[model samples]
Target: MPTTAVDPYLDGNFAPVRKEITTDNLQVVGQLPPDLAGMFVRNGPNPQWPPIGKYHWFDGDGMLHGVQISDGKASYRNRYVQTRGWKIEHEAGKAIWSGFLEAPQMDNPHGAYKNTGNTALIWHAGQILALNEGGVPHAIKLPELGTIGEYTYNGKLVSAFTAHPKVDPVTGEMMFFGYSFMPPYLQYSIVSAAGELLQTVPIDIPQPVMMHDFAITENYTIFMDLPLTLSAERAHRGEPLLMFESDRPSRFGIVPRLGNNNNIRWFESSPCYVFHTLNAYEAGDEVVLIASRMSSTSVLVSEDNQLDPDANIPRLHQWRFNLKTGTVREQQLDDVAAEFPRVNENFLGQKTRYGYVGKLANNPLPLFDGVIKYDLSSGTSQTHQFGEGRYGGEAVFAPRPGATNEDDGWLITFVYDEGSGTSELVVVNAQDITSEPVARVIIPQRVPYGFHGTWVSEEQLTINY
Candidate 1:
């Protein structure tokens, strides 16, 4: 069989949905809560051309889908982020550069390595930015989703930005770091509430690792230098990347927010990897980090996804890094096979009682069949399964306007019905996870399974952009 046809990521729900669409009034199944006025936006890859070689899930142009909710009504729109790579390919009418699974098309005159801004979408400091860790973020004005072009923090960002950035809910400051395959392997940066690039500090690491996400306390920032390092040898051989190094120590770098780079304390953990973090905060003498941990990043099942009960699957885990003793303690939070953990945006960087995750299984297709609401206090949980043949994305918690309690809001996600080939914006009441949706804004077209998403309130979106 040909290589392109054999790639699973491009064939199922991961397949690109190329149509750019806008619908003013979307169909709704139930009443859209009056106070639930915000936008649920998600980012995912949608390639413009067939790959010059085999394509990875992350190696494609970005497209953002947004469902705007206001006054019991909903609307939908999607636009591709016009990154440098997208524009170059647009003019060429074909794929010029071979992607992750193939050698780079070095002869192309554009000299463009794919900065497919398709990883995450974050709205902060009044700006909504489409992000891919490979390059600087592309700022787009929404409700329009039009690309306003690359944002370099006034040219302060010299390295690639991570897809996962933490916006300090209390201070309104954004904390982020970038890792590269080249020298100055890791860099930490902070953006002010006013959207100014305040600082960029280069932190030394032994090697370049796929540090997908990090954590923060009031006084310090955390870094994960796991073992899944990018392989130059594999790239030279045109093989799949992110080669795991078993002999390499899985280390975490802890740095004070504004302290000296020389003060970074590195702690060693058992070899493992974290794709996303649930939340983190300071607790007494320790900084607690909650994230989904897997024994390995490698897939354990066959292409047909035969279930392996013995397969080492990802489960929610908690890691406590003692600030005083420099000791690290770890424990698993849940046994469910899950990924894509989230917390209420307002509770970010603080101790919270609730966290949510999407459940996964060994399957040929990427399917998150249900969402779990975990109670951090009692170790209890409630689940909301999108019935059989139905799937959902990472659900974001939207706090009710002027609400007091942390869970007093709604959980929103994009649900795609496999049988019908259509998607819907399902709004689950956060307080009652197992309850029926308060509203279902139906999307006629399939919103392909993607990565991260967020809930942005209307208050922040006062102006277009």
Candidate 2:
């Protein structure tokens, strides 16, 4: 008898939690910040049933783990984003659709692929949207984490929405783009502060690629045309659906916030991929972009993908695009391996001095044993280790009320202890990243490793809900 090989993504902390738990008065290791009044919600994949075929980490269904704090008290809750596929699988009692690792199942009753809303979250126009770039946004209610059904902006959003959208802190507007596998591959849209879908413009690209995220500045939006090409012909030929072409040059398109394809300018850079961006801003004639840059990646496929295993680790990098001179200058800001970079939401789309990122571990799988705070101005960084055998995901900055300093806030994330088989929400002072946690709210259940998250303040919740 032969033993079955275990998929690393489905084992240990990467595994899913079956229970949907809601508990109040969570035990806190230290005093919860009296001023930290908000909910920290992180979104990631949690498949409802065993997958139909070879499963990728990105194929799992969407689940949300949220910790709410008010008046020095804390509560915790978790729920699955009830998508159409989830509901169908719930009724069918098993997975019907295949994942990204397998070829398309055109004969299935449901679509070929499941729209796992497991990527990221955004709060805009009084609604919390659980986003997956493959499909439309699902509106989720806070506190309880209930799905409010799919939000289409009154039939205006006929295409897939980007998981990463930019909400201008000053303009009170949201800017996002959607990519498709078909022609007319890219579209950009903006929503009013009041939540109305204002405009949608088509942007031209040579081919469809898996563009996970982009960047924004106060005056412009930046799109990366990387070499991660998506091909339907290759799928039909029974090959990997995605391929990383190192021979192809990476293109960065700069478009005015309200401009169309004709007004966009393109800049070329060495072939690379950027999964997440820290921030971007305008400085005189240059547009600055800070992000985690990778020389190549094996995220979707490995065999014949032409990826450098050692070069796959993303590092803090910066690129300066000169609009006046049409020349681009790029540099590696830090040598440390990290990803899931975030800045203070209030300072997004503008020049900021500080950033928060998850420091990657030495393990074969994707894991963060610590968090790093980078001082971009001085090129110095501080790390907050989660102790031994502990790991965490993205760290979101929660700005203190009435605080003016850029680092005057809290960095909140879910930390899972492999030694104890338990998880807890850790809160640290943004000013002192190396210090002990301000508080740790021990979760009643374990939280699986996931992707991006956001901090929704009490003021925003009060106005929205």
Candidate 3:
């Protein structure tokens, strides 16, 4: 890592790497699974130049890192998302827009502000979108991973797109909603499996909240209207414009699959914040929502906010909303702190027993030292630690081509070995996570730590444009 001034996110494994390379026939350890064929792409913050002011991990430029596997051979490549903001900065040869922690400048020929597109990357409508909740998505060309330009659902996307969108495995319909800092605070949209924007509806909300992610079931789409919010008046007072409010109550708005905004039923719960959900499903007349919840989001007050560094952090929390009696039940599922929850796509929006999440370290920084596999049936879990001085990104499960069992797959992730200052693509057997990895494809450079990712199967690759 390069020596620099104090920057929380720019140091350690979170440091930025400025090079992009492509190489085939990567070196591998152990035997690679023959059934695992496709690409695993992850997005993270990688700034081209030093930030002008305070930097938030989410404000850095977007970069896509991928490893392709065919038969037993693996290949690797990475590139910037080529967003409008990044291109402008690249041309100027220096930093322009201020980071998430501050306001942006008024002089910009590029229409959009810093849509760095640095967040979750997912496959939808036969296209891959590099996303950031602050703005719309940038579509990246498939296979080669080149930026094609901004995707607007064919100009139907009137507002920003969410970094997290739920794709139904049954209908092949992708359900997404976007929240903004201004009027029409929230809106929901649906995209067809064939890459067409079918419908969009304006949603009514009392105020703008940080809706990072949401959940979907067989019939309902759940949206979180938590307390943390952004305000222009508060910014002038020197307080963080976007912050968590202690007096506000958390609300969950449950709406029908194809219903309009007026049909929403808002259910209140204890004030909390959720960055990601494990999964959601339907059981009788109740909707089950499982996510990683934080009791108070005060830690987001500032980039250096560590209100309770020694205290227990966010954990697996469960909530059951009944459609019959208008009542809500909530409880803690586990004591272990975890985030970036993922479930097998084979069982998305349906009842299943397993879930995968990254286990947080003891340090004040948000780093995952291990991955935990949760068995919802027995209330038990198995963890795979990357040993000391090693950290990993989210664990995404890749299903076997024609497997019957839900857990019959492999858990894929990028592990950064801080000691060696290098990274590797590790594949762990989903059925037995505690055992050694099935294979480890060595990546020549370090993969900076970031947020959520997805697994794109080879069959999906053939259908994309």
TM value for model 3 = 0.96
lDDT of each: 0.84, 0.92, 0.87
Poorest 10 consecutive residues by lDDT, candidate 3: 303-312
Mark the 10 consecutive residues where model 2 has the least summed lDDT: 302-311
**Model 3: per-residue lDDT, tens digit, 1-465?**
998677879888888998899999999999889889999999999999989878888878999999999989999999999988899899999988877665655565654268888898879877889999878899887678899999887688887888998899888889888898788899888888777888889888888888889988888899999888878678778778788775788999889989778899989998788888889998898899999998876554555363644223789999999989889999999999898899998788898899999999987788888899999999999999887998898999999888999999999999988899889999999999999899999998888997777888998888666
Alpha carbon lDDT at 18, candidate 2: 99
**For candidate 1, which ten residues in a row score worst on lDDT?**
300-309
* Candidate 3 ranges beyond 4 A from true positions: 1-4, 106-112, 303-312
Segments in model 1 whose C-alpha atoms lie over 4 Å from true places: 1-6, 233-241, 299-312
Clashes of each: 2, 0, 0
Specify the highest-lDDT model's number: 2
TM-score of each: 0.94, 0.98, 0.96
**What are the per-model C-alpha RMSD values against the true structure?**
2.8, 1.0, 2.2
